[model samples]
Target: MEAQVINIMTYEVIGSKDKAVAVIAYGVKTPKKLAKNIMKTHKNIKSVLQKTGERTGVYRIHPCKLLAGNKNTEVIHKENGFSIKVDPQKVYFSVREAEERQHIANMVKSGEKILIMFSGANPFGIAIKKKHSDVYITSVEINPAAVAYANKNNKLNKINRVRNICADIRHAKLEKFDRIIMPLPETAISFLDAAYHFAKKGANIHVYTFNRSFNEAARDVADTCHMFNIKCHKVGEHKVLPYGPGIYKFRIDLKV
Candidate 1:
């Protein structure tokens, strides 16, 4: 039997796979008419949620209100396939994303040449470049289409210091970067070799990983580095995503 259509007041579009979209939250037993109405009002949201091998999904439409008294704030565009909105969502999260944004800004001031692997739309790099003028950034994205959209977003945001490279990050031959950022934990573990090559000795690397235990996940990374005779110390850890009760997505800062 076909499941009854439900109106989800909160939803996200995920770009980690083909047809990246998802309805994250809604009241139980919602009616089809309500779901239909939501789709009608938010015409850009695609229904299918695509999952990449990393098991991470991408959201096409991200909504948040940065102002007071604003009924809704929806970030919608044509770059990816999504248009659903989550009301009352924080427009700017003051979490790890905020910290990473701050760190990017700091690096720009020190004239650090940065490379972002798995940069989807390169929002993290773009935010820093906008605030700091001295830094040069090269963002590598695996998806050609996503790279295109990142370029468009750069233009839309009036940012010019960012260079978008569309290629498989794991095999791309590029200069060593002073700082490297990998935000996607699902596949980040497999891309450590890429990070090692692109990162200069004693460079700062921010990596994401997925594991049932945070310590175990971090230990796996440390072990991976040790095998290569590369000494790495975990400088910090944060819960960037909630996968489950104990299994969570973690971001670890390492100094090589």
Candidate 2:
């Protein structure tokens, strides 16, 4: 038996070994066929969803429609050494950022205070706490649902030091942090001033941005620092993922 490929399957799976859910990107031309293929290939994946629209607004969540099997979207996505109970429809998350989160975790030093902006389901916070139990973490997110999930995930991971703040980063009242992580690639650059506001001297801010090239990403960071009247240096740059055609999401580390 042979079946022609309707379109290249661009999808990601969430959950652990027992059961999982598949999410297909919005650009997939034949999502149903792709969902069928995903279900066939991954026996553990019991539910499939396809994106109905691009990620819009500040929430970074898009509408999703069930394409196959059960309609459940909530799943305990386990990675590294922690588990996060999240509903993809209710919050923004990316299984593809697993390694990126790990890298950010590895950058942390013990007994340091860290802040994460646009924390979503607090995946980066979990990753850091799992690796270094001595560090204190604070996560700020605007979406109430995501903040709820972030708290639940903290308890699920048995992590006790994370403080979840439900508000815009600009309005968040907090002390200075030794390190900061900004995962919102769409408009992270615009929030550099906020990051600087809560940053201690000699702090490192890991900012993720999408641009045509790494140089352009670094330039944007430099320009933002200049615009904010903050003294900073570009310490590192990393390609996190491919966002679109000829566009890459880069992590530009700013040392203040």
Candidate 3:
């Protein structure tokens, strides 16, 4: 007999394969029933979860309700030839940002000292190590849970040369780096001065932000640079994702 299927349009699969497939059925009126139906129809999916809250707090983790199959929330997410173990309920992990992480990694030159701010689960640092093995990276995150998972992921991926630090970037006594990455688009600009302070002369800083238009994104970067008295030139601007109806998450690469 064929198992029942839920409407694909009403839900999204957040992660998959060799583990439980996490699905968010926020738009579905009968989420639990839909989740159970998904688990019954999809053989590869061992579990189904409904997202319970918006991602919030310093860790950016969202609460989830298990509707079917196993109770485990921890799972291995394989991407870019690496295995990353993360518990969505404990720490933030976005499959959507995987490509953006790799893009940043591709921009790095060999032997550069790099700092990744808000390096959640070390995906950014690990992607860089996988692409460019010679570079030294310091991955800083405020959430202890994220830091632990990041270290675990680094070991799982056999990635070396990345130093994971669990502390607020503003309070961490960090050495100047050749390239600084600010990945938190919502508030990356607020930390621009800290990035400038920790960057060596002629360093490249990649700052991500959210704005309604490309012009506004560029202006935000330029205004932040002016506030820091740093000479900033836009190397490139990329629209990472559509944040809302008219707003977008953008990355503005700047040279100082």
After superposing candidate 1 on the true structure, give the runs of residues whose Cα lies further than 4 Å from its correct spot: 1-10, 13-34, 37-109
> Number of the top candidate by lDDT?
2
Question: Can you write out model 1's per-residue Cα lDDT over 1-256, one digit (the tens) per residue?
Answer: 1111233233343222222223333332433443354445544433422111222233222332121112333233222221211121322111124445555455454677889887766667666676666777898877665676677667766667789898878667789888889877766766776788888888888888878777888898888787766666888776665665578877788887
Off by over 4 Å in 2: 1-9
lDDT of 3 by residue, 124-221 (tens): 88888998989999999999989999999889988788999999999999999999999888789999999999989889999999899999999988
Q: Tell me the tens digit of each residue's lDDT in model 2 across 12-98.
A: 787866678888878788889988988898777889998898897788987899999888778888787689888888999887788
Candidate 3 Cα outliers beyond 4 Å, as residue runs: 1-16
Candidate that would win on TM-score: 2
Clashing pairs in 2: none
Task: Name the 10 consecutive residues with the lowest summed lDDT in model 1.
Answer: 79-88
Distance (Å) between predicted and true CA of 174, model 2? 0.5
Clashing pairs in 1: 13-58, 13-59, 13-60, 14-57, 14-58, 14-59, 15-58, 45-83
Q: Tell me the lDDT of model 3 at 115.
A: 98
User: Which is the better candidate, 1 or 2, if ranked by TM-score?
Assistant: 2
